[model samples]
Target: MMHLIRLELKKGGFTSYLWGSLLAYAIIACFIMVLYFTGNNLGAEGFQNYEDALNAINTFVLATFIIYASVLLSKLIINEFKDKTIHLLFAYPINRKKLILAKLSIVFFWTFVNVVLANLLIDVLFITINQIFGYVSGTLTITLLVHHAIYVLLQAFGAAGMSLLSLVLGLRKKSAAFTVATSIFIVMIVCSSNGNFNLASIIAVPLSLAVLGILITYLSFRNIDRVDVD
Candidate 1:
């Protein structure tokens, strides 16, 4: 399982994607900071309250991050099948279910860590700027923080499930780009409509997605038993 996990992580291109996501996050942070610091009245209305602005930023960032996980990391699972590497992975002593779960685990863990780190960096920069302007005295409620944390967990799991579903669809249909495009479209539509995409929505969407993926994967794996890999 460890070997499979390592292989999956390597195949997912985490080293490059991680840097890319961080760079994107940094650019966004810089842009937001510029907007916050530039005192010029650009003839546009500003946020009504700090809380409103914070929530807006949080929601947008969270959604974008989830989409990132969906596209960059999760797509690799299906790519492996499209590239015909699954035979190599499954021919070893590792169980097929273990292999599938390993890929899912790596992608999920990577997504969670990346999101948390990105948010932490954003929070630090925002807090630092607020402190510079004597605006860092607001107290945070435990309930609010807990809610945000729960939302983060749900979003990550949802993206993981989406990726797994994408993999299954790709493998089953032998189309990597199609699966990726479909997953991205679904995520965009959900997020654009102001849907929470939280635990409840994830449970509804990704669980169904996972079930479909598992069914496809099982059928494919079982069918592979009768086919020649030469």
Candidate 2:
């Protein structure tokens, strides 16, 4: 499995995507630090508000990670068909299940990396801003840090599921572009809705969609094994 992932990385060039996401996280971290420093006048939260700031931080991080995951996953898996490389892989002893697992593992690994990078970036930015602006008197506690960490993990899990689902859909449809466009459209509709959309509209909708994606992926892989490469 590890060897399979290594090959996928070499052929798919996913490291470049990982680097690109790191660059994006850096840019966003800097922007957020500047905004926080500029806006945090009048000594409002006073070291206690980091917890309060967490929810806002989560929104930004989730949005940024989703865009990266969706696009990268689509290109990685979908392009296998569009580029006609699925046939190349089948020429080896590997089966479709192993190949799909490799792709899924890559997605999961990147998701973990994103969570770490994002949280570290946010914490570093917070400290830098505090030091530069002379707001370092308040003590940083582990409890506050743990809260942020949990939220980041939750968001990453959501993204992992979504990315896998997106890749499966794109591969099955044989159109990375279409899957990406439809995903953006669906996200936009969800975003445009007011908060009145109900509880089910929020959690149930996305959770259901993600669940559907997993099912589709299973079905796609099951069918792929039955496909005639000739």
Candidate 3:
């Protein structure tokens, strides 16, 4: 399974996706910094402290990661079918279930790692900038750092699970547009809700979505052989 995943990474151009994600992260970090500094000018409620800023940034990124995950699914899974490359994959000596699982594992792992690392980098950069410009209001403490870390990790898992669900939906219909549209819908629903970023909603929403993602993944994989590549 590990070998198969590595092969997929190498052959699938996942490195390019990783680089793109990092670039996106840098852009997001810079945008958040600009927002922090110009909150009053923009007539937005400025972050009350480091915790508030972290939470706001984490929430936005968690939603954005769904879009990233969808793009990865399109490139890694859906494109194989669209391009008629899945026939070659199906011809491999590997079991169909294992092959599909390996692909999903890559998507999940990549999405989760990107979310966690990117958020961590953003937090560090925001803090460093805060130290120099004093734009942010809160002081960083060990306790706060640990709390934010836990929050970011939990959200990352949730984002990964949501990505899987989106992939399954898109792959079932073999439509990249459908897959990405679903991701956009999810982001809209999540961002539009007033409680989505709060602790209770964060824990509850992701857990619910993660459970749904698992069920959908199981159903999708169970019928892998039946997928119509035509």
> Which is better, 1 or 2, measured by lDDT?
2
Ranking by TM-score: 3, 2, 1
Instruction: Score candidate 2 by lDDT.
Output: 0.64
User: What CA RMSD would candidate 1 show?
Assistant: 4.6
Which of candidates 1 and 3 reaches a greater TM-score? 3
Task: Please count the clashing residue pairs in each candidate, in the order shown.
Answer: 0, 0, 0
Reference-based TM-score of each model? 0.69, 0.77, 0.91
Scored by lDDT, the top model is 3
- The candidate scoring highest on TM-score is 3
Local accuracy of candidate 1 as per-residue lDDT tens digits, 1-230: 78878887776667887788878678768765665555223544333434443444554454555456546533655656667777787688776667766766776676567656665677567766776774324555667667766655655555455545555555556675666666566556544533323332434564465456456655655655456543
What CA root-mean-square deviation does each model show from the true structure? Answer: 4.6, 4.4, 2.3
By TM-score, the better pick of 2 and 3 is 3
TM-score of candidate 3 to 2 decimals: 0.91
Taking the tens digit of each residue's C-alpha lDDT, what string does model 3 give over 94-154?
Answer: 7888888888898888889988988888888888888888867656899998988887788
What is each predicted model's overall lDDT from 0 to 1? 0.58, 0.64, 0.81
Positional deviation of residue 166's Cα in model 1 after best superposition, in angstroms? 3.4
